[model samples]
Target: MNSLTAFARPVLRWGGDPSGGAPYVFADPSDPQTYTGFDYEFAEALADKMGMQAQFVPTDWESIVSSLKRKEFNVIINGFEPTGDRAREMLFSKPYYLFRLQLTVRKSDGTITSLEDCKKYGKSVGTLVNCAASRLLEEGKYRVKGYQDPVGAYEDLELGRVDAVLMDVAGEMFYARSNPKLKPAGKPFQTGAYVVGIRKADASLKADIDKAIDELINDGTIEKIFRKWNLWDDEQVKLRTATPPAIEITTTKLNWSEGLIKLFKAAMITVLLAFGAMFIAVILGIPLAVGQSNGGPLIRALCTTYIEFFRGTPVLVQLLFLYFGLPVIGITLPGWLTAIVGLGLNYAAYESQIYRTAFQAIPERQWQVAYSLGMRPILAFRRIIFPQAFRIALPPMTNDFVALFKDTSTAFAIAVWELATAYRELANATQSYLGIGIVVCCYYLAMSLPLAHYAHRLERKLQRKSTGILSSGAEK
Candidate 1:
């Protein structure tokens, strides 16, 4: 029965990010269980024209192309621009929708009115990462901040975090248009068209999608979809007659050495964020652990509550709250600083548990021995109790430090641009995910393996010292 059902209706899987929101693919605010957008309508129409059932596969916008390459979906129907770098990695169908760059700024910002003004004044512009607008900003040497989505960039613009936002006109239409605080700074520029992306090996699928797109255009179906979404304009009529502007293939060869250097720099950021966060974790963890182990009821309750609250919530949410939510309260932290503080606070909970357990594991005899030797409580704790507890906690602490390296990838959410972000950007640009991924893995292993090995050796050496000390005490 399953086989027959599969044969009866072949599925054309198209992928996109609904979080990108509105006019492209998004949850219908009126009915979120179903998606509604020009892209969604077009996908359904294209699939129907091809005698197949449409299946929408939700994917992150950053890894959409890579997801297509992985065969997670049959085609990418997201707002993918045909670039030479992308063309080398995949086949592009006939242009589906015309698009151009729109610059948006806060209504009160009179200092920056246009892209030229942004450039002349050295203003910061925000755009989606790894997209054409970001590349254009980079080429023009403007201060550019990249967000995971258009909405984020627009939000930052409204918050005055960015002087302007340069993104696709569609982004402005859906996000900035409704916001009374933001206005289009200048006329749209940089004409481009959205195209469906298929894997390079899927020539037959490409041909079929192209045929379907042509049919949709010829039959006025595409126009109807655009009109329904209020996206139809004089510019889109050109899609019927005009070929998409030629994709300029970059002639300059990719410098693997340069790419490696960039990845190395990003890896260093990962290291620094991890180290800084872990340092904070250790500093705070010790106090919390000590408080919980030996303090009044109030102190113990506070420490326990702090530990439980941070441990229960996800680190990503904490980071987002620190970076985005805090800005609402006039507490704006830089991305890297927020990442460090967020991760530190989250991990300190676990670290405190580790320390508390180690503290408990120490026999009462140790304390009695220190007191018998006439050592003060503080001196005994510093010289004997802490040293012993620290040794017991060392292995786990090292393990947590190693894990922190990978967790630093979450910094990408707040735009710290750590090793993981570097890998994604490089992989997308070079279309060499396998090679770049292996290099990134090697970089992580390089950072982690040494510490792990040293921790093991130190643990064994400490065990030996401990055993020898016991033997000496017995002999004495």
Candidate 2:
């Protein structure tokens, strides 16, 4: 405990709050990164004053509060907006920055004129789970769904899955500016204040953080930090502007199962896609491999070129090229089709290589001997080459199949339903471990058990055949 306290890691949950005021805290949609915003700069300045190296670690926004409450960190230094109710759960530093909470609907969505307008349309309200807008809507009559991050909410909104995304004024602006593909709703709802949250019991740490805020405010450091991320605009310093629910809502029990089902569905899709693609790849691969190795120089060059192209690029790029770019050039495909085709083609290229190595091991003399014995080329291969190659290829092919199954989950980007997507939906919605556990078990059983059984059977069959010859022909 002493050693741990002396070098305790101060972790802050980024992307936790919905305002997205700190551009640093907003998660990058294209990457696995979460950042700390300009407000986080002030937090770092405090660590410097205390002579402590504060290493910033990003965690799930939804679960961060519980982690902070449990003392996962010495402090929750990410910019946190504390409601009076939330204040009961955690201590608050002085309000470092005031942000305007806004209601953002697609500019094309025409119906949502105000925050209250969402109630009339029966359009689901989108917000970060546990975000301020979510809490406000929880007590109101609007159908609200809390998502894992701003991107999720924006995605749901853009897809028309939700009528509007509730965020602070600056956030809606940032998102709108960055993604010209999306249109923000007509106007924004204004809110009162946002602050940095800390464990309530840490009155000492609270004082330290609160004191830091005071210094920043007095020295203009707060102003500089917000300016850097473009949060210092009217939205950052001002607390109110346009809309908020007239009355607070009391949240109801979420169905939670709907979220679970969505998760399971996603995982199943991924498993099937990967499993399906690998099966096709393995089947198709054998022919290409055989052709490349034995089909003169021209066919070998063609096969080599195909393998290099697919293996050289990232799987995601391949998927996108097939789904998005191909349509531009006149080849239109369905989402599932794109996933299956892309995955199959890519793995086939790799599988061809794997199979080639084993197929080439058959002695060139064997083919000549078979021909000398008057066996046709096809008969020679069927009766001699393939059976031996199969035994040799078994282990490596098994290993490849195992990896391909996991790779199937990446089809989520193409909107292909799979295990990984399902778990992501579940993890975001239920915000629990249930879906994750189920997915882990499902994939493990799906990939490992069948491969294990097949390997065992193949090994046994190899022993019995001992190269598929009826007799060695040398009398024992």
Candidate 3:
């Protein structure tokens, strides 16, 4: 049976982050469990035109494009702009809504109003990372903070973390429109258009969507949806009246030649992130283990609190907290350093527990023997108990290294493009998520498997030595 015809109700999954709250996508205030937004309605209309039921998939905007390419959804209608870089990776539908960057600020604070005023006052602005707002900030040499989403930037403005928020006019309408505390500072700048993102390889799908969007425009269906959200504007009307060119899907053969070099470089970065994080883990984890095991009551309590705090919370949250949260306290850290510290601190908690268990498992008789030999307490621990504890910890330590290596992929949350991030980019660029996924898996395995094997071998060797046996399986 044909897959399309087999389903009772064919589902077209649309990816978006509803937490963005407002005209774009957010939980329906009337019904908390249900979603409602302009984009949500637009997706449903598109799915209806295609004779499919729209399935809303909640996704983070930072990785929304990546998620679309990963086949997590069939389309992304989350106000994705048709930028040059993204155009090359994915097919974009006709512009459904026109947007411009609206500078928003607290109404009570009138010292800064325009971009020039912002520059003069040395005011820092916040914008969504990798967006046109960010690009504008970069080109203008403005001190800008990049956020994973527009909501976060606006929230920071509310909290005085940033002086202003440079975001889409549509976003401003939803987020800052009715607020008595905030107001638009000046005229919107940097005009752009919002479009639906479709997978490049699925040219037919793109063509169908473009046709449906054009139809929606002609029949005034989209205008009704826009009006429902109170987003109808002159630019939208102009877009509707203008003729749209037919979509031309140029099917390009998947090429890995250039991607291989990029993937290798990214893999190297992953290695750096992983090993760097692990180095921090081990160097700090050992001392933490010692403190918890051998230190006085206060020291032990402090060590326990530290271990439980990190281990209790998620690594991603820790990373984001370090990167974004610290800037609030005037302690901004670079992305690479944030990745290292976040991963290291998180893993140290786990590694400390492993070391503690190993240390405790060692018999006190060994310490007694060292004392009888006239060795000092610290010396006895260093020379006798420590070696055995390290040996006992090696197996779990090896496992942790492997796990930590994989965990480094999360650094992409803070814009650190490691192996997984590289693969997502390559997959989108080449339109080969399946192929790149395999390559990335192999890359991780190549990095992790050998270490695990070696650690196992060393563990076996230690076991044999402890039993007084030779390699030939005979007694020494």
Candidate 4:
């Protein structure tokens, strides 16, 4: 006890989505700076039991599993379920809490009640992506629409965009409770337990966590934590008493051919998304840049505002707003269209600055020479100014194109599967993060390397031409 008290706090980091709504892991409504949830308290308690201090690591829920595989955190305990696919990748502690799926729908909608009914009628059901509920819906052959957050899913149900939302009982209870419009449609289905996902290679860590979980349950600490969050249930109480079997460790063969085929197919989508977005950005950015540079005060202000607004915000937020948020006001865009437009508009702001800078870099004497030659403003720009600016901008433009190639992965926010998403799914299933990560990185490099090489050659060619022009003038 003296040795333990003498030591400093040892931090145990666990990742979760604080914006993922209440009773799980979210910011305190009363004090946004502080986080309070069942998972939050449970993590703290579990960490204390292990002679450590719990530190909540906020992560994007969509890629949370991959984040774990990357060792961003010691464990994933944000109501994570132990699935066969996940088990192959990570070790899990005994069940800490049990939950079941709840179908949330509009109170007015009395026709739909169960997953089977929704599937038979082809109703668009909403759920969080890559979760047990979503997998259940997909495996049942139901038309499932995935959201980044359960709040968004419930919002869709409220706005009549989706017929129903399939989420965990706790999420539905916390998020949909006291809502006049939405209600839980039927009894919970597919009962499951929440387990702590640990690194499979770290068997010692897994054993430590399992021991801590047993101690928490034996001492009634886990139950008290659940009661504090008003999440105590009979199944969870039963889970505390029940003995859990040891986690089975398994290895999967690296099927490079099949993985490569899947990667190439998804990479095609990445290429299309990048090309389509880059086309719009370049086309719009040139004009916007010109306007920002030469236009009157009002036009400049408008152009500046457009550029800052898109550049200031995140691309993912814009994609989600366009694809899901707009439907609330009756504007529903297709996924591909939303991905391209959102990416294009956001990047246009950045590209405009590049264009403007390149335009300014060219000598003012060039424009004067064009005017002196009796050339009109439009002709001066087309014949002389644009060519030089294009040369200056080409390098940056190539860099931006390469950047946008990787950025296309953000399209996954709007449910467009690209290379990154492809590898995440493949890596999770095959438990081959290192191998798959290398391959995916190679795929990106394969696309960008040629563009970079060409850019390098173009720059050198232009440099030689400029030197020759200077030498000719000096000789004359």
Choose the strongest candidate by TM-score. 1
- Tell me which of candidates 3 and 4 scores higher on lDDT: 4
Q: Write the per-residue lDDT of candidate 2 for residues 237-296, one digit (tens) a residue.
A: 432223322222222233556545655556566666777788789888877887777788
Ordering by lDDT: 1, 4, 3, 2
Give a tens-digit lDDT track for model 4, residues 1-476.
46576268788899988886578889998999999999988898899999887889998776777898788998897888777777766787888887788998899997888877897778889887767786677556687777778876787688776899999888988888778998877788777778888888989988888889899998999889888877788767666555553322222344689679978988888888899999999989977897899899999999999999999999999998898778868887667778899899988998999999988777777788899999999999998888778778888888898899989999876666589877776675556779999999998998889878988899888776562212112211
Question: Candidate 4: minimum summed lDDT over ten consecutive residues — where?
Answer: 467-476
TM-score for each model = 0.88, 0.62, 0.68, 0.73
Compared with the true structure, model 3 gives a TM-score of 0.68
Q: Which candidate ranks first by lDDT, i.e. highest?
A: 1
What stretches of model 3 exceed 4 Å from their correct place?
A: 1-15, 28-31, 41-76, 80-95, 99-148, 151-233, 245-258, 453-476
List lDDT for all candidates, in order.
0.84, 0.65, 0.80, 0.81
Native-structure RMSD, model 3: 7.3
Q: What is the lDDT of residue 424 in candidate 4?
A: 71
Least accurate 10 contiguous residues by lDDT in model 1: 467-476
Clashes of 1: 0
Candidate 3 Cα deviation (angstroms), residue 27 = 2.0
Could you tell me which residue pairs clash in candidate 1? none
Q: Which 10 consecutive residues of model 2 have the lowest summed lDDT? A: 241-250
lDDT of 2: 0.65
- Residue 430, model 3, lDDT: 46
